[model samples]
Target: MSEHPIELSTRMIDTGVVDTPSNRVTEELSELADGVAIVESFSHVVAVRTDDGLVAFDSSGSGSGAQVVEALRRWDDDPVHSIVYTHGHLDHVGGSAAFAADAEDRGRPRPRVVGHERILDRFERYELTSGYNRMINMRQFGGAARSARRLDERPFLPDATLRPDVTYEDHRTETIGGVEIEMHHCEGETDDHTWSYLPGFDMISAGDQFIWNFPNCGNPQKVQRYPVEWAESLRAMAAKGAELFVPAHGLPIAGRDRIRTCLETVATTLEDLVADVIEAMNAGAVLDEILHTVTVPDEALDLPYLQPLYDEPEFVVRNIWRLYGGWYDGNPARLKPAPDATVGAEVVDLAGGIDRVIERARATSTAGDHRLACHLIEFAVAADPSSPAVHEARRAIYAARRGGETSLMAKGIFKSAEADSTTVIDGEAPPLRMIRDLGD
Candidate 1:
């Protein structure tokens, strides 16, 4: 949108813009240093020129892969020496096939795709949970929120997705064209995450571990994240004294001091959250109490790099508890809880009817208690899921909920809920489950 992607990114970074064009893949290449550059994509491709060829970190994504390769070609035709996966996330590594295809077209051996040893397991798990991934991803980004559209039955790890050819245990160091690159495994967003550093350039190619947003160790839809170790990894990268800091998803920072502040602030935020959550747990507070009572420093959140735009702090607290404790939230009623519909039907009977509950939910929502309003609406929907009136209220309430949220995670989920209700109101045969209920 600006003259250049980096300019756009830097402007957003300086102005504290969370909805950034940097996250968009333009398939344009910009050089940061001699023989080093970045290809702007959904997940960027950071390349280092080597006598052997080009060493690239991350390959955009499946849909954007071909464009990313084309963008890099416009800058340099050097065959890719290697492609490093910052992590196994689809956006980061999904484009590996394009890189391999390019190598074949140029009559060269495929670039070695390198990643942590756990990546294979991650891929395997994707295969096992493809439906779930499709559901969550659609909710996270597609605004599909339990939509009636057919979920993709194919494996989430597509045939185009490439497994890492070069795997390392914890740390791996090697020289590509005489420049040393260090890859270190850090469990944060993903257990198999790796961040690379080039001492020669004093630049760190931080994977999602240091995304511009608050540490994504709190992605509610995903697996257990390592916040404690995530902070440790950020500190480790900061201690490297890197001059140029390139993250997988945001603006590349140039100054050493700026880079250190970002790394330390994010690390400190996580460390503080961990300490507070653990203290609350030790003091015999339930998970709900800790969730409501926990507070993140406003100062930390005010920092550009530490914005809770994607994953916020409270989710991080829940993740911390999950890591240290079990799924049991210390609520005996929920330990072996009755089904929502059963409980909601009972509540509806005591409260007069579903209509009365919906009216209260509307008032709660009007009073700016969207959280409580959603709860009441959910109970109403559970009690009489087929009622158009209940769904209409759900649609409006969730739209309000989505509007008030800052983080993408919260917004996406709320938007999806809104979409779900909208679907029923529109009467497009609802998600198959709803149709089945109608038949019953």
Candidate 2:
């Protein structure tokens, strides 16, 4: 791997070369300014030395949270005065326990945990939908989902999540260790997102708002994301004229001009997407038509930071429709549609038999129409679940779909489908059962 593994890896995955100047990640503590430093863990943690003590932003992911604390100790042993959570996502806030434990070990006061007021609601929802989150995450991150599971068998959001002791509704300014820190709430990847700015150092800790990849405004497996407001928030941060930009998931950026251009470009890409999507929705375009019509400019997509690595633009279009147009996809037939298996049985009968349907699915996949091939193969599988040929075709089609995907979320979902077909072919237990067992 190259020194900047993420940039090198992305180049290989996106353009088959290592030339683009992508986000740089370093294992050691990197100082962004006089008092600001960052530890690049699974999710980076930002630390600011204040007159009273140290103010930290985020604690990395749960598995690496303790390690992050250790790394920070190596750099500076100032007792943590406060920790600000940018959001309630597991990766950003799941490591609070380690921070708390560190405080106790050092005989220091428990660091005050602060975050958006909606953070409590997010944690409550996570508890309520633990199983669903586990399933979705399994299909979103593939095999790595196993490590994300908590000891309590819940995956993604763990039971150890630390709720904010101090909550702010839209904006809050705190003088921590004599350093003024401003927290501004915005709806982006999560409703409970907070971006912090320090005027003393002219630095912005942008949580996940400026993750190096395309803005993750369209996560297919998760809740609704605010793209319109997300863009607006980025613009707000850009107007701050911060000299150093630090994101929760990627390397820190220095230089005011470089930071401003990056922020504006991301904002413009999302702004264009939201505008096109809302325009199509107002014109009464259906979801499918809207998806085809609203598109991010190819020039924007070509930007290294805007590449679709974690989430794609097409998914964002669907999210926009969902936000504005409701669940009805404008297809009357699907309003009160029959069960998928029942519809598949009808299609299989119309196509003669399962074998014939499988043959056509294989041909379609061979012709590079994997989407249509998967649709046909799904019907064949539903029509005759016991057919080995149908299962083989289903597996092959989904594998092809997985191979063509750019986003990790898309690939994981396709891989899950392929895994299901393999489970049936190998005479193993159902995929859901396996997932449940893994959680246990």
Candidate 2 on 1-440: residue-level lDDT in tens? 23443334334435534364345434357666788888877788999998888899998878888888888898899899899999988878888889988988989887889999999998888878887787777668772232233323744576666779999899999897789999999999999999999999999999999887899988988999999899989999999998888888765776677778888989988888888888777888889898777777777776767788889999998888888878899999999987666777899999998888999999999999998898899887766665667778888898888889888888988887777777667765444433333332
TM-score, candidate 1, is: 0.94
* Residue 56, model 1: Cα distance from true site in angstroms: 0.5
lDDT of 1 by residue, 208-270 (tens): 887777888888999999988989999999999998888888778777876787788888888
TM-scores for candidates 1 onward, in order: 0.94, 0.91
Best by lDDT: 1
CA lDDT of 352 in candidate 2? 94
Give the clash count for model 2.
2
Give the total clashing residue pairs for model 1: 0
lDDT value, candidate 1, whole model: 0.85
Q: Which ten residues in a row have the lowest lDDT in candidate 1?
A: 431-440
